[model samples]
Target: MTAAITPTTREALARRIADLALAVPGRVRVAVDGPPPTAPVELAEAVAELLRAAGRPPLVADARDWLRPASVRLEYGRTDVDMFLDGWLDEGALRRELLGPAGADGSGRVLRRFHDAGRDRAFRDDYTTLAADAVVVLAGELLLGRGLPFDLRVHLRMSTAALGRRLPADLGWTLPAHERYETERSPGKEADLLVLSDHPERPAIRS
Candidate 1:
C-alpha cells in the first residue's frame, strides 16, 4: 500500500527535481508526462519555480504548442484516438526546436513555441537563451516511449477511475489514448521519478 501522504508531497517532488538540476552538470532536460487529469504541467510549473529558487535557470515547453497544424491533425477528424496518439504532435519540431538545441553540443537557446493548433498558424517569436546549466521542463501527455532524449523524466500517474472521474464530459473521448499509453509505453516504468497523482494536492509516491 502507498503511504499516507500530505499536501506537501507535490512540493517535495518539486524540491527533488530541483535537486536533480543542481546535481546534474549541464542543462537538465526533464519530461513531465501524464494525461491532463494528472496535471503534469502544473507539476512542471511548480518545479520550474523551485529550480529558479535554487538558482538553476528553468525553461518550460508545452506539447500543445508543438502540435501539427489543423490540416494535418484533423485529416482523420477529431476524436480519433489513433491520430491523437500518433499523428497530432510534431515530434520532429519538438526535437529540433526545443530538445535538441537545449541538449549537449548545441546552444542553450530555445524557442517558446512552434505552432499553435488553436489558431492554426506558426509562432513568430524568437528563441530565449537560457543559462547552460538551465533546466527545461517539457510537460504533456503521451510524451514517453517516444525515445525523446532527456536527462530526467517524471510520470504523473493516475488510476483509470481517477482519470475518468476527474475529466469532464467533453474530454471523455481522450480516455482510450491515455489507457493505451499506460499499457504500451508504461510511463511509470520509463520514468525516473514516478508520482501517484490522483489527488494533485496530495500525491503519493510508489515505494
Candidate 2:
C-alpha cells in the first residue's frame, strides 16, 4: 500500500535539509515544483550531502516555470495568459529531443523541457523562468534557520542590463529582487553586503 501524503513531515525534512546546507557552506537545498538541473554533477553531490547530513534521503524535486519573457512581464501576483503562452512550448517535442525517451506524461514532459531550456538562457531569463526568488527564499530560510533576519542578501553573478533584456518591462526588477544585480549593486548602485568574486586576487601573488 502507498504511504499517506505527509506534507508536514516533508516540510520538516525540507527544513532540516536546509539547515544542514547552512552548516555546510557552498551548498543549498531547494524544493521546487518542476524538474531541477540535471548537469553539474557537483551540484547534485552537494545537495545529496546536505540531505544525508540532515538524516533524510535525497528525493526527486521540481522547480516552477516562468510564463513569459521578462520584457513583457507581470508581477507574481498577477496572471497574464498571453505572456504565459509566449514562454510555453510543446513539452513532448522538447523532451524527446533532450532525453531520447518519451517522458512519463504530459506534465512530466513540460517540466523536463522547462528544466532543459532554463539552463541555456540568460541569468535574468533563467531566474524568472524558474522563479529563482522562491529558491532564494527557501535557501535563506534554511541558512538562517530560525529567527531569520528581516533583510537578506542573495547573490547573482550576471549583469543586470544583459539579464533584463530577456524580461518584459512589467516583470523585470532592479537589484536585490533580480539575480543579475543582487550581487554587484545594492539599492544605490553601490555594492551590496554580499559580493560575488568571479575572479579573486591573492595577496601573496599580487605583492
Candidate 3:
C-alpha cells in the first residue's frame, strides 16, 4: 500500500505548478495526464485553484470533453483496446478548437467545452478570451506523446497492481491499452513532472 500524502506535500506540489505557470510569459497550456482511476481531474482542479489564488486566471478542460462522436469511437467495438487507445479522443478537433487557440502563437480565445459524452452531441459554447498570463489545465488519459503543445506536462503514474485494483470490472478491457502506453509512450519518463499516484492519498514526485 502506498503511504498517505501529508497536507504539506500536496501543498508543495500545487506551489510547484503555480510557480511554473507564473514563469511563463504569456498564456500557458498545462496537461495533467493520468489514467481515470488516478483521478487526474482532482489534481487538475487543485492546480487550477492554486493558480487562481496566485492571481492567474486559470481554465480547466477535460480531454473527455474532446472525445469523438460515439459512432466514430465505436467503429471497431465498444471494448476494442486499439480504438480506446487511439480513436476515442478527437485529437484533431481538440487542437483546432481549443489547443490551437490557446497556444503561444495563436489567439487566446478558447472554447470552454465541446462534445458531451453522455448525450453524444456537440457542445456549442462561445469562445472566451483568456488574460495574457492566463493558464489552461487539461486533465485526461493518454495526453502525453500526442505531440500536443503544452507548456507544462504533468503525468500521474500508478503501478499495474494499483491500477488493476482501482479500475472497475467493466473497464478491465482497457488494461492492455494502458500497458501499451507505458511500453510505447513512456509518459512517466517523457513528462516534465511525474507523480507516483499508486495511492491517491499518498502521492510522490519522481526526482
lDDT of each: 0.85, 0.28, 0.86
- Which candidate wins on lDDT? 3
Clashing pairs in 1: none
- Candidate 3, TM-score vs. the true structure? 0.93
lDDT of 3 at 154: 89
Please give the RMSD of candidate 2 to the true structure: 16.5
Overall local distance difference test of candidate 2: 0.28
> Which prediction has more favorable TM-score, 1 or 2?
1
Flag the better candidate by lDDT, 2 or 3.
3
Off by over 4 Å in 2: 1-45, 57-180, 183-195, 200-207
Against the true structure, what is each candidate's TM-score? 0.93, 0.25, 0.93
Ten residues in sequence with the least summed lDDT for candidate 3: 2-11
Q: For each candidate, C-alpha RMSD in Å?
A: 2.2, 16.5, 3.3
Candidate 1: stretches off by over 4 Å: 1-8
- For residue 81, model 1's alpha carbon misses the true position, in angstroms, by 0.1
